[model samples]
Target chain A: MIKTMKALIQREFWEHRGAFIKAPKIIGIVLLVTTLIAYITIRVTSAKVNGEAILQSGILELKDMSLENLILFWDGMFIGTSTLYFMVLFFVMYFFMLGSLYDDRKDGSILFWKSLPVSDAETVISKILTAILFVPIVYSLIYFVVLILLMIFYSIILLFHGLNPIELVWSPAQFIKGTLVMFSGTLIQAMWALPIYGWLMFCSAWFKKRPFIYSVIIPAIIAFSWYWFKVLTSLQFTNISVFKSPAVYLGHAMFPYSNDYMGFSGIQFNDDSEAQLSEILANLFASVQRMEILYGIIFAGILFSVSIWVRRYRNTT
Target chain B: MTQMITANNLSKSYGKFEALKNINLSIGKGKIVGLIGPNGAGKTTLLKAMLGLTKYTGDLEVMGVNPFKDRAKLMEDICFIADVAVLPKWISVDQVLDFVEQTHPKFSREKAEKFLKKTKLGKKQKVKEMSKGMIVQLHLSIVMAIEAKILVLDEPTLGLDIIYRKDFYDNLLNDYFDHERTIVITTHQVEEVEHILTDLLFIKDGEIVLDSDMEELTNQYFEVMVSNDNYDDAISFKPLSTRKIFGKHVMLFKNVNRGELEALGDVQRPGVADLFVALLREEEQS
Candidate 1:
């Protein structure tokens, strides 16, 4: 089973190299170029002013900032970059999950796949693993590499300005901690979004045409119609609103670190108080509700089973 | 002889239409069985049932496994090329080889690569980048490399030129088929596959009209070509079907003795394509 799943995951990567490899590399290149252009512009502008005085003042200002504030600033930069990465990641995975099964069927390649020794359940599970585990892990690794490249660029700039690169930038403890935090945060976010991925996969397997319509538009319509029906009839059929309840849950789960849920109140970058960064990370991770995670897992499990069932019986031309 | 496939009272339907009606068959190992039928004649339905690609009622087993229930397990010893163009168009040849090698315990990557070396296909060429003929060649190479007990081909040479089609069958017979392997195939070009088939099945309107071994077919059925003067006498034997060719009347007889038919006019064994048409015509008339 592990062997088959591993092969299946490799197959996914082969098919979607553009999304898994090329897109992240392209993003990295674009970011590096933009940073280089900005650095050159800064150097050109700083040369017009007294370069030595400006560099000295910048060094003084960096020295004055507390280590906690520096770590926080870097953390914010990491989070900001990750936010952009996740936004692109979401669309890439969403469309990939939506089209993965449908494209095979449409092109009549599903029959070839079905001829293999692997079961339909195995195939679907491999796809789920690819979306939830492989994509994020690969993306994070590439993002880390890009982050390191950007840091090297920063170190080069600092070296030119007569600042100690090791002292001002490369804090080993913080870097390792931040890397761990990014991976854990991305994984948790994936778990939170499992239901959506499951739904898209189910749609991909089941729908004959236009999986987007069936997955997204149909659900939206059903939810809205249910909402209006409750309002007009004034009868409480079910305690849970089909759409609104999950929508609210998804909103909260997606933005766990939002101020409304987990206000960063305890972590102070004050000169005297040395806030433990681990505590802040723990608090952020804890803000995700246990109940919501449970529900998400249950929902995702059911959808994944349905997707497997669909794959078993779906006949492609 | 070991039975490769057994079906008893196997039937399939779609909505109000029945695609297969109580099919009962047992195909033995080492024989090439050709499934022949017209369009919508349940040939594909039966193949799909056997391959576990479709659900069917009644007892059906492939290599002693209930195919629909344990398709994955059954597929380990069975390989199929449902069509010539079923491989995903985006995958490169090397990737396909890698996947098959990794997933299939019986697949030989070295053999597949060797088979591909004979073709003009490059290892890095994707399916979409190759021509239709090359794709079929690539598919055949991969399929032949798998050490399977049963190999099913459904129109495996569809849309190929004569050279490629002939080459496909040649490779199947020479490189793939052996004493231990059984082959079940369906094709619109009955005559093309007729020479290679040891057993023949004729389906019409979701029912098997005729099922017989090639030797049995030769002994039991004959086509008599009678001139205008002998045509009236030949008609009395109740031929399955009759059609005119040039000035002679050709009548197909299912069970009439060859000696008896020879007394009417020139008699010979009918080709598979001709026999198929005659069987379907007989079924419709009945």
Candidate 2:
């Protein structure tokens, strides 16, 4: 069973290598090039305009800063770059789940897949697992590698200037902490995004024509109809649960380490920057354990089962 | 004891349009059964139900397994080729092989690879890069490697040219078919498969018009070419269908005495294609 599942998931990776493998590499290259160009532009502008001394004084000032701010400086830069990756990961997974089941049916390959000894449940679960677990892991690992390469680029620039970067750059680096937060944070993101992912997969299997359009339009129509009904009945708009329900899930899913689903608050980062790694990690794991998330998970389970059932019978668009 | 596919009053309908109407079938081991039908004649629908790809009423069993209830378990011993070019265009030759090796316990990687080596297909060739014939060859290679008990093919060579179409069935018969295996094929190119089919099934109007072995068909159906003088006598016996060829009346008769047919004209056994048309026309007249 395990071997079958591994093959099925590997099949998913092979089928969607563009989204899983190439997308991350392209994102990494664009980010690295943009960073390099920006740094070079800043250096040339500063040196040509006689502002090099000001830039020099900035690096010298980092030496005099306290350990706390120095660590914050390193973390702020690391997290800033890593933020784009997690953002792209969400969209990559969204589209991956959307097409995972539908593409095969459109191309008539669903018959080929169903001809095998693997059950529909295993195939659908492999798709879910690919969206939730495998893609996130691949994106996170690439993000980490890009971060390391960016830091190494900085080290080379410092060495070119005949200065030791260890005192300012590597000394207060949050390598382990940043790696832990990004990898663990992406998993939490996927865990919170289950309901939305479930809807995508369900639509992928269920809809005969334009599953993407129907997946979005059907929910939009429901929310619109319910809002207008409430507004017209009471002569004032009061109940927005229909609109807010999916918003809450999407919000928490899009932004990781937010408040509990019940609380409906956004990320807890403050100006003081006193938050510890453990505090944020604990908050993320704790927030998804709430009853609200539990309900969402139950809803997701129902959709996933229906997705498998639909895949069993719906061999074509 | 032969493991046979048995269907009891099997019926399938899409809305008001019945695709298959209470069709009962019993296909036994070592027989190559050709399910010949016209468009929307329920041939594909019946094959789908047999392969567990669709829902139907009544009981259907393949090799003692309820196909719809336990398709994956049944697929362990039964395999199907739904159509030509159904294999994913994005999948590479090597990747699909690796996947089948991992997923199907009965799949033999070495056998598939050996068959592949005999062709010009490189390991890294994707289905998209290969021609229509190559894709069919690759699909056949993987299917042949698995020692399945029952093989179901639904128009397996629909779009292929004459050479590829002939090659497709030739490989299937020579390398795949055996006493331990049962093969059920549905095709419109009846002439190619008529020589190979051991049993013949003719379905039309969502019902099985005729189901009998090839030998039984030879006994039941006789086609004769009668001259203009014998045409009136041939018509008296009520031929199932009459088509004019070479200014002679070529008639298809059902269950007529062979000695009388020989006396009337030059008698010959009818092909499944001719028998099918005669049967379909008979259904229409009734």
Candidate 3:
């Protein structure tokens, strides 16, 4: 079973190399280039206004910052970069899961795949597992390359300014600790995002064509109908629950809210006060409410079972 | 001999149209059965049932396993090429081998590599980059590598030129077929597979009109070429169908006297394609 699943997942990676591998590399290049251009433009504009004094004062301010503040600045940089990566990861995974089960059927390759010894359940589960586990880990590895490159680039800029980057940036515990936080955060986010993945996969297997439009339109119609029904019957237009629920689930997906320092509570509550790292981690872990994750998982299980059953019969679009 | 496939009163319907109606067949080991049928003849539907691809009523078993219920286990001993050029176009040749090698326990990567070496296919060549014929070649290479006991092919060579189609059968005959294995094939070009098939099945309009071995089929159905002098007397024999070629009459008959037909002019065995047409025409007229 493990062997077959490994091969099946490997097949998924091979088929989706554009989204999983090339997209991240492209995102990294774009992020790097834009950041470099932005920094150079700011340096040129500020230098044109005041020459070397403005640049020298910035270094002096960095030199005067306490190690605690430097670490906090470093944490901010890590979280900011991580948020970009996670946001792109979510979008990439969204379309990836959306088309995963449907593409083969559309192109008529499902006939070839069905001729093999693998079962329908194995095929669909491999795709779900790819979305939940494989894609996140692979995205992180590529994301790490971008993160390290940015770190080195910043360290070089600090060294050019004659400041010790080791003390100010590289030596901080936030680098390793931030990664651990991202890992745990993503796993939690996977659970949080399960219903979306399951729904997309079920739509992929079930719909004959245009699965994306169907996946969106089905829920939209349901939510709209509920809204109209409530307004007509009870006239309670103030408290709307239908749209808020889906929007919250989709809202959680676009934001990496479970990562330390990314959450609002993880940041400092008081103005001009140093944020404690321990408190940030605690807030990050605490923000993940257990009951919602449990419900999302149960909802995901039901959706996925239907997807597998549909896949067994629906070989072509 | 052990039966590789058995279907008893098997029937499948799609809405009001019955795709297969009361198909009863027992294909045994070491036989290459050619399922010859015209369009909408339930040939594909029967193949689907045997492969566990479609739902049908009544009893159907392949290798003693219920196909739809235990398809994964049944697929271990069964292999099929559902159609030509159905492999995913985005997949590279090396990935195909790597994938099948991992998932299939009976697959021999070495055998696939050996077959691929003889062709111009490179390890990195994706299916999209290849011509239609090359894609079929790649598919055949994979099928040849697996040690499956029963192989089912539904129009495996539908759109190929003459050379590729001939090469397909040549490879299957010389390299793939063995006494321990059974093969079932359906194709439009019956003449090409006539000599290769051990048995013949003619399905038309959701019914198996004729089913027999090649030897029995030839012996039962005979074709006679009669000169102008013997044409009327040959017509009196109530032959299934007749046509004129080169100022001589050719008539096909089932279970006719061989010596008496020799006296008319010349006796010959009709090809599967001829038999298919004659049988369908005979059934339709009645």
Please say which candidate is ahead in DockQ: 1 or 2.
1
Candidate number achieving the greatest lDDT relative to the actual structure? 2
Expressed as tens digits, the lDDT of each residue in A1-317 for candidate 2 is 99999999999889888888998889888877886787677677777888747455433445567778878877776666656676788888888888978988888998888889999999988988887888889988988897788778777777777767786678877777777777887887888789989999999888877988988998899889988988888767777766666776776677666564432564566566845555566776776676767888888999999998888866632
The C-alpha stretches of model 2 lying farther than 4 A from their native spots are A51-68, A229-242, A260-268, A274-279, A313-317, B1-3
User: Would candidate 3 be rated incorrect, acceptable, medium or high by CAPRI criteria?
Assistant: medium
Q: How many angstroms is residue A41 displaced in model 1 relative to the true structure, after the best TM-score fit? A: 3.1
**Model-by-model lDDT, in order?**
0.81, 0.84, 0.83
Q: Residue B161 of candidate 3: its Cα lDDT? A: 91
Question: Residue A251 deviation, candidate 1, in Å?
Answer: 3.9
Residue B262 CA displacement from its true place in model 3, Å: 0.6
For each candidate in turn, the TM-score is 0.90, 0.93, 0.95
| Model 1 misplaced regions, further than 4 Å | A44-69, A171-173, A229-249, A252-256, A259-280, A314-317, B236-238, B263-265
Give the higher-TM-score candidate: 1 or 3. 3
Q: Write model 3 residue lDDT over B250-270, tens digit each, in one string.
A: 899888888888899889889
* Candidate 2 colliding pairs: none
**What value does the lDDT take at residue A58 in candidate 3?**
38
| RMSD list, candidates in order | 3.7, 2.5, 2.5
What lDDT tens digits, residue by residue, belong to model 2 across residues B1-286?
5758999999998999989988988998999999988899998889888888888999998888888888888888888898887899999999999998998889999999988987889999999999988999999999999989889988889889998898888888888888788899998899999998899888887888888998888888899999999988999999999999999999999889999999889888897788887888778888
Highest-TM-score candidate: 3
- Candidates 2 and 3: which is better by DockQ? 2
